[model samples]
Target: MRLVFGLVLIIGVGLAGFAVFMAKDYIGAYQAQLDAERAARANAVPTVEVFVVNRGLRYGEQLTEADIRPVRWPENAIPDGTFRALAEIFPDGEKKFRTVLRAMEKDEALMQVKVTKPGADAGVSSRLSAGMRAFAIKVDVSSGVSGFLRPGDRVDVYWTGRGASELGGGTSGVTKLILPGVQLIAVDQIADSDQSAPTIARTVTVEVTPRQVAALAQAQATGNLSLSLVGAKDDTVSDAVEVDQSEFTGETVAKEKEVCTVRTRRGAEIIETQIACPE
Candidate 1:
């Protein structure tokens, strides 16, 4: 009986030791995995919730709470003017909704410049900057860039007309660049910039300052106005461009010879004598 008891005790002790060894290995592995997970979380990029359009939206459409949703965006890479919360987009708890100024696609961030203020309509006025005015200019196939202009394009205005003889330009009309890089706010009556198809617009509106409006008005009244499309990425300032019939025909203008005269009184008659012009 004593021998059997000793063998049973030894086997029980061995089983407990083996179980403890396996448990220690498992705990060490679990602790290592937990530390790795914590390190990964510390290195992860920070993000913030920003509002984005739930679906594609068009210009002039009203934006409501249902049309937008929140998405996690990298905190450092968030775009300027992006709405960060519902209160920022809809302030004062007012029921007024904003109107889209530019078309937006699904998941696009909402920006202040892309939408009008609450209860405001998206119109040409909204696109104009402070102290800017909207002026309408008539256009045709030849002057409107073959109907390829859109609402958001910039153009150079050219005035072609006869100048007074005192100004050195004669009956042959002169084409001069009146305006450089003026922004187009509306093509015909449409203010939306999403227009892709080319349509021959009879009249196009441009955003300009009060001084520019006066100059354009006078130029349009006295001469014919033509528009030249400017490249979207072109930022070089255009020099003063003036083309006349003489330059177009490759003819050089001739300068008249200077003449000088002297007057001498002889009795009752006044005589004029020719002399060399002063140096």
Candidate 2:
């Protein structure tokens, strides 16, 4: 009887120890799962639905229902001038009536600068700022920066023409910088600044002030206008640039020869004198 009681007591203690170990493992697994879930929630980024282009759009292309759709964009990554609701952009059932000002790739967000006002198309007149005028100039393969010029590029305008000689002789050829940091608004009839490749446009339009318009008009009429491409971020004003034929050919301009002469006076009789002139 004593051996039986001892065996029963040992069996009960072993079962209790096993139950404790199993309970500890179960609790540890539950805690690990909860920690994992909390971490995932904390690392998640918030997103919102905003309209994006479903198809690539070019300038003057009309925006329709099929062209745009809503997609999830991170709230923190949302760009400015984006529309969150369709009604705000189209104003109730007018999706196919608006035009785009600039080109947009697929999935690109619609911004204020990329689109035109309601019921308006992309044109040169629409892009002009207040008190600004659009001036057009003739361009060619050589004068137009080898057809690499595009809208939104900056250019320096150089005028080449004949100017009256200071020596009162015939006109002399002259070339000088007339305008700098001028913003190009269009290449030919295309006002969009989103050109993918260089093209040779016959005409280029630039945005200018009224005073600049006058200057550019006279310069274009009197001389051949040439465009010089400026740096993308360049704001440095260049020094006065003027070049003449002598300067271009790097020839030493000659100075007039100095001469010496004397005047002869006669009493009641005029005397003729042939002598060297004074300097």
Candidate 3:
């Protein structure tokens, strides 16, 4: 019986020791997880705060840090709140966080592109830049003229001038297209002009180079000019006359077309007048 009791005691002690060992291991593992979490927290870089607000801004606008702020930040992540302040020290720039107002408008070419003194040496003028010598010719496109015509639309320009085909005639002179294709920079009324009602004049202004400006001015003064809505990115050049109309079509047609009228007097002295269309 004594030997059995001693064996039982040894088993009980062994079981207790095993349980203590397991508890120790469990505690160590839990502490290790805590240490790892603490180290991660220590190594974590504080997040910067940037806020976005809705403002109507033009394209290519230089953004400053003051333009944004973080409305919310993670707890204990930012040490001195320097991230929000750092944006101010930065110069005007473009960043992923910076938003544009007219991003969806998409008609950027209609927006006037001006070259300031600072922008002059930026190589923009050396290429496809619209400068002071350029001219913005306003063309009235009434009826279905303005339909499907968005800003930055490209078009082909045609003019009446002496050409080979005309020269072949007995008169030894021919009327032909002078300029075929021109880029439409803006499809809008001149600035500060009313464009709300159909009766109101809505002019489509196009930008042309100095030489082309002179040609366009002469064309506007002497010949009738019209616009074909070429809803395309690239300027298409062709001699084909898609729309054949009188050269000098303005934006709006007249309100009352006819001026003459026929009148008859009845026996009761009732006067009746019927307006007639122009012949």
Candidate 4:
């Protein structure tokens, strides 16, 4: 009976030791998992909900609440003019909808500049600023930059015509820059800025001031106007640019010497005499 009791006590000690070992391993694994989760949380990027288009939208299309969805976006990477909430996008309570000004793809963030005001249509007038007017310029294949221009592009207007010569007497054919860095608001009645396909536009409308409109009207009436595409990211102001046929042919033009003459009027007869030119 004493031997059996000692064996039973020994067995109890062994069982307790085994239980402790199992508990230690389980606790160690749980602690390791908790540490990993904490590290992941610390490294996670902060995000915010932003409205994005659920499907492709084109110019002039109405944007409604059903066409958009909210998604988590990196807070630091959100684009400017992005709508953060449904109320901000639909402030009028769905009585009116905004029109798309530019084309957008699925999941693209809706921007303020990419849409028109509530109940407004996408038109050239919507793109104009205060005190600005829309003027159309005729263009052909050669003058239109081979049909590569779009609505949002900037261009330099070059006029080719006969003008008074710099040397003072006769007229000469000259090409001069009439307008620089003018913003195009529409191409052939299409105000869509996202038009990528090459189109042979017969006319392009530009936004200009009242004074500029007058100048462009005069230049277009008296000369052949051409367009030169400006780079999208270029902000450099163009200097005075005028090129004549003499410059193109690399030929020097000589100014004629001035002749001063004194005339005395006689009855029904006039006599002319050569005199020295004034210094």
* Candidate models: Cα lDDT each: 0.91, 0.86, 0.45, 0.92
Cα lDDT tens digits, model 1, 1-279, are 999999999999999999999999999999999999999999999999999999999999999989999999999999999998899888885665899989999999999988987777888888888889999999999999999999999999999998643334346668999999999999999988988999999999999999999999999999999999999999987899988767767765555577899999999999999999999
What TM-score would every model get versus the actual structure?
0.89, 0.71, 0.40, 0.86
Candidate 1 global TM-score: 0.89
Model 2 lDDT tens row, 1-279: 999999999999999999999999999999999999999999999999999998888888998667889999999999999989887677864534568888899999988778876667788877887899999999999889999888889999999999865544566788999998899999998787888688998999999999999999999999899999999988898778988776657655455666555556788776666577654
How does candidate 4 score on lDDT?
0.92
Which predicted model would earn the best TM-score? Answer: 1
lDDT of 4 at 190: 92
Which candidate should be chosen as best, given lDDT against the real structure? 4
Q: lDDT: which is higher, 2 or 3? A: 2
Give the better candidate number (1 or 4) by TM-score.
1
lDDT of 3 at 81: 22
lDDT of 3: 0.45
Ordered from best to worst lDDT, the candidate numbers read 4, 1, 2, 3
RMSD of 2: 5.1
